[model samples]
Every structure is written in C-alpha cells, then in structure tokens.
Target: MIQIGDRLPEQEFTFITEAGKTTATSAELFGGKKVVIFALPGAFTPTCSQAHLPGFVVLADQFRQKGIELFCLSVNDAFVMRAWQQAQNADAITMLADGDGAFSQALGLAKDTGAFGGLRAQRFALVAEDGVVTELQVEAPGKFEVSSAEAMLKRV
Candidate 1:
C-alpha cells in the first residue's frame, strides 16, 4: 500500500468535461499542489452516490479555502464519471476516471469484487503535497469511516 512520504506513481487519468475528453498525468495533477484525492469502488453505486461523493461535494469550498484541490476518482469510464458529476451536482470536485484500474493497482489499492464488479478500487482517501503523500485513510472491507470527506476535512 502507498504510505505517507511516498510519491504518487506515474499514471494518466481520464477527465471528460463539456469541452471534450482530456488526459491528465499524475504529475500534472499532483505536482506542486496540495491535493485531496478520494477513490471509491465504482460510480453511481448507492453508497458512493448517496454519501461518499456527496460529502466531498458539500465540503469542496472548505477544502478550497484551505488551498487544497479536491479530486474524486473511480475505476469507471470517463463518460460515466462525467455523468456522475452532473448527477451529483459536484461541479466543485474534479472527477478523474481510472478506467483501467492501473492507478489503483500501482498504489496497491485494487480489489476484486467477483460479480459485484470485476476490478475496482478500494475506498480510500489521501492527502498529498507536491506529489508526496502526507496522510492516507483507507476503509476496511464493507465499511466507510476514516476515508470520508467529513473525516478527511478534519484531518487536513
């Protein structure tokens, strides 16, 4: 698992917006910036739709006020991520698509869910400064707690 003081691995993430499809490398997103990144199993799922993503959306301003960029990541396609962003009215959050799960695997956060979903990212959140992790919060199987937006907000 990725730990505090470890730099984010080199990876590219997809971002779909009203303009068009674009790609952002890990370095481009985290380099020289204070960033908060939260990853969920999949997009549009119950827990993620109702609580996980919404929490971040609701507290985006607070994170911004503290000079931190907020990112919501998932192992779904760019199109789905874009739709979820719109559905959740999460305009303040930057949604990134880890379509291939490569990023999650690199961080040792990928999990197999059998029928629930093939390869998905475990629920996790981390605080990084200039590409190096400062803090990490990972939830246990079938649980949501430490990695939540409200919780991470207090920690950051």
Candidate 2:
C-alpha cells in the first residue's frame, strides 16, 4: 500500500471505448489537478458495485465542488469496466481498467482474488495534487473500511 506524501505511482492503463481503445498515464490524469483516485477489486462485485463505486458516484458532484476530479479503477479489462460504468450510470467518474494489474502492482496494492481468477486491486483511495499523493488509504481485502471516498473527503 502507498503512504501519504509518496509520489503518485504510475497509473497508466487502457480504457476501451466503443469508438476504440484509449491509453492514459497517471500523469495525464493527475497533472495540473487535484484528483481523487479509488480502486476496487473488480467491477460488478458486491461491495464495489453497490457501495464503493456508487458512494463515489453519488458524491461526485460534491467532490467536484471541492475542485477534485474523480476516477474509479478495477483490475478487469476496460471493456468490462466500461460496461459496468454504463450499467451504473456513472458519468461523473472516469473508469480506468488496470487489466494487467500494473498500476496496482506498482503501488503495492494488488491482492490475490483466487476464486475470482486473478490478482485484484485492494480497495484504496488516494489524493493526488499534480501527480503527488497527499493522502492515501488502503483497505484490507474484503473490508470496506478506511479507503472510502467519504473518509478521504473529510480529510480534504
């Protein structure tokens, strides 16, 4: 898990769209902005779909009011993430799929979801300003404790 004050990890990943797939790096997302990035184990899971992602979605306008951009990530492929986003009607959040688990691995936040058949991203929330992390919260697997959008919102 990353610690507060650490520089933001490289969060590059692919975001597949109907038009075609797109590639983005963390620098592009966080540079020149105060950003809130949250990660979940996978898209369409119990806690993630019902609670975690929706919490951020419902609060997106409030966060934006605070001058923060929102991003939600999962270890699934971008196509899956995109579909999930549409299902949930999440236009306020940028859905980034870390399909290779590269970003989570680089930040040491990947977890083994054996039954789920892959390494997944541990639940986490990070506050980054221009690509530097100012606050971080990494939750234990299956526990939706600290790394919540609301918790991070209070800190901000």
Candidate 3:
C-alpha cells in the first residue's frame, strides 16, 4: 500500500461531469492542491451510501474551510458513480470512477472480493498535498474506522 510522503500514482480516473464523461490523471487532480480522497469498495453499497459518502458530504465545507478538496472514489463506472452521487445528493464531493481498478492496483489497495462480486478497492482515506500523501487511513476488511470523515476532520 502507498505510504505517507509517497506521491500518488499518475493514473486516470473518469468522472461524469455536467458536461459529460471526463478523464483526468491523479496529477491533474491532486497536483498543487491539498485534497482529501476517500476510496470505497463500491458506489451503492450500504456502508458507503449510508455513512461513508454522507459523512464527507456533511463535512465538505469544513474541509473546504481548511483549504482542502474532497474526492470520493470507487471501482465503478462513471455512469454508476454519477447515479450514486445524485442519489446520495453528494454534491459536495467529487465522484471519481476507477472503472478498471488500475488506480487502486497501482496504490496496492485493490482487493479481490470475488465471493461478494469482483475486484474492488479497499476503504481508505488519505490526505494528499500537491500529489504527495501526508496521511493515510485504511479500514480493515468490512470495517469502518479511522478513514471516516469525522476522523479526518479532527486530523486536518
């Protein structure tokens, strides 16, 4: 897994924007910015929809007040990600689609949950300053803990 002070991999992420589907690299997204990135297993899963995403949405302004940009990433397609974002009313968090799990694999955070479905990213939250990680919080399998928005709020 990626560690503190490591630069985020320059991987592409697709996002369904108002204009349409768009692709951007990690550098384009994280370079020269202090960003809070949270990766979840899937877009519409119970824990992610009910708590993980919502916590960040609720705490969006607080993060912004600290000059941080918030991004929510999932190993789903842009269409699914867009739908989930709208369904959750998470306008505050930028939804990123790691459609092929390339980014997750690069970060060494990919897990094969084939029993449940397929390959997915582990639940994690990290603070990246200008593309370099300042802090990282990864949840245990089927658990939510330090990676939460409230926890990150305290840290930031």
Candidate 4:
C-alpha cells in the first residue's frame, strides 16, 4: 500500500462536470495542493451513503478552511458517481470516478468483494500535499475508524 511521503501514481479519473465529461490525472488533482482523499468500496452502498460520504459533506468547509481540497473517490463510473452525488446533495465534495479501478489497484487498495460486488477499493483516506502523501489511514475490512472526515479533521 502507499505510505507517507510517497508520490501518488499517475492515473486518470473521469469526472462529469457542467462541460460534460472530463479527465484529470492524479497529479493534476493533487499537484501543488493540500488535498484530502476519501475512497470507498462503491457508490450508493449502505455505509457509504449513510455515513462515509455524509461525514465528508458535513465537514467539507472545515477541511477547506485548512486549505484542503476534499475529494471522494469510488470505483463506479462517472454517471453513477454523478447521480449518487446528486442524490446525496453533496455539493461540498468533489466526486472522483475510478471507473476501471486502475488508481485503486495502483495504490494496492483494490480488493475483491466476491458476492457483494466485483473489484472495488478499500475504505481509506489520505492527505496529499503537492502530490505526495502526508498521512494515510486505511480501515480494516468491514470496519470504519481512521478514515472518517471527523477522524481526518482531528489529524489535519
């Protein structure tokens, strides 16, 4: 798994914006910025919808006050991610679609959930400054602890 001080791998993410579909690399997203990235298994899952995403939404401004750009990533496609964001009314967080799971696999956070789903990202959060990881919190399987927005708030 990626550790502190490690630069994030170069990968492209699909995002749906007002201009339609757009692509952004990891560097383009994290370069020269203090960014907080919270990644989850999939979009619209129970825990993700009820707690994980909502936590970030509630604490978005607090993270911004510390000059951090918050991004919520999932292994779903851009259309699903955009729809989920709209359903949640999460305007504060930037939704990132790792449609192919390439970024997650690159970070060694990819896992097979079998019957629950296919390949997906682990639940985790990381602080990146200028494209390098400053802090990383990866949750244990079926657990939610260190990766919450409230938890990140305490650290950052």
- What clash count goes with each model? 0, 0, 0, 0
TM-score of 4: 0.97
Candidate 4 regions with alpha-carbon error over 4 angstroms: none
lDDT of each: 0.94, 0.85, 0.92, 0.92
Q: Residue 12 deviation, candidate 4, in Å?
A: 1.0
Candidate ranking under lDDT, highest first, comes to: 1, 4, 3, 2
Best by lDDT: 1
Off by over 4 Å in 1: none
Q: Look at candidate 4 and give me any clashing residue pairs.
A: none
Q: Any idea how many clashes model 3 has?
A: 0
TM-score of 3: 0.97
What are the per-residue Cα lDDT tens digits for candidate 4 across 1-156? 899989999998888876799998888989999999999999999999999999999889999999999999899999999999988888788899988899899999999888878889999999999999999999999999999999999988
lDDT of 3: 0.92
Cα RMSD of all models vs. native, in order, equals 0.7, 1.5, 0.8, 0.8
Q: Is candidate 3 or candidate 4 better by lDDT?
A: 4
Error of 4 at 126 (Å): 0.4
lDDT of 3 by residue, 29-126 (tens): 99999999999999889999999999998889999999999999889999999999999888888898988999899899999998896989999999
- Where is the poorest 10-residue window by lDDT in model 1? 12-21
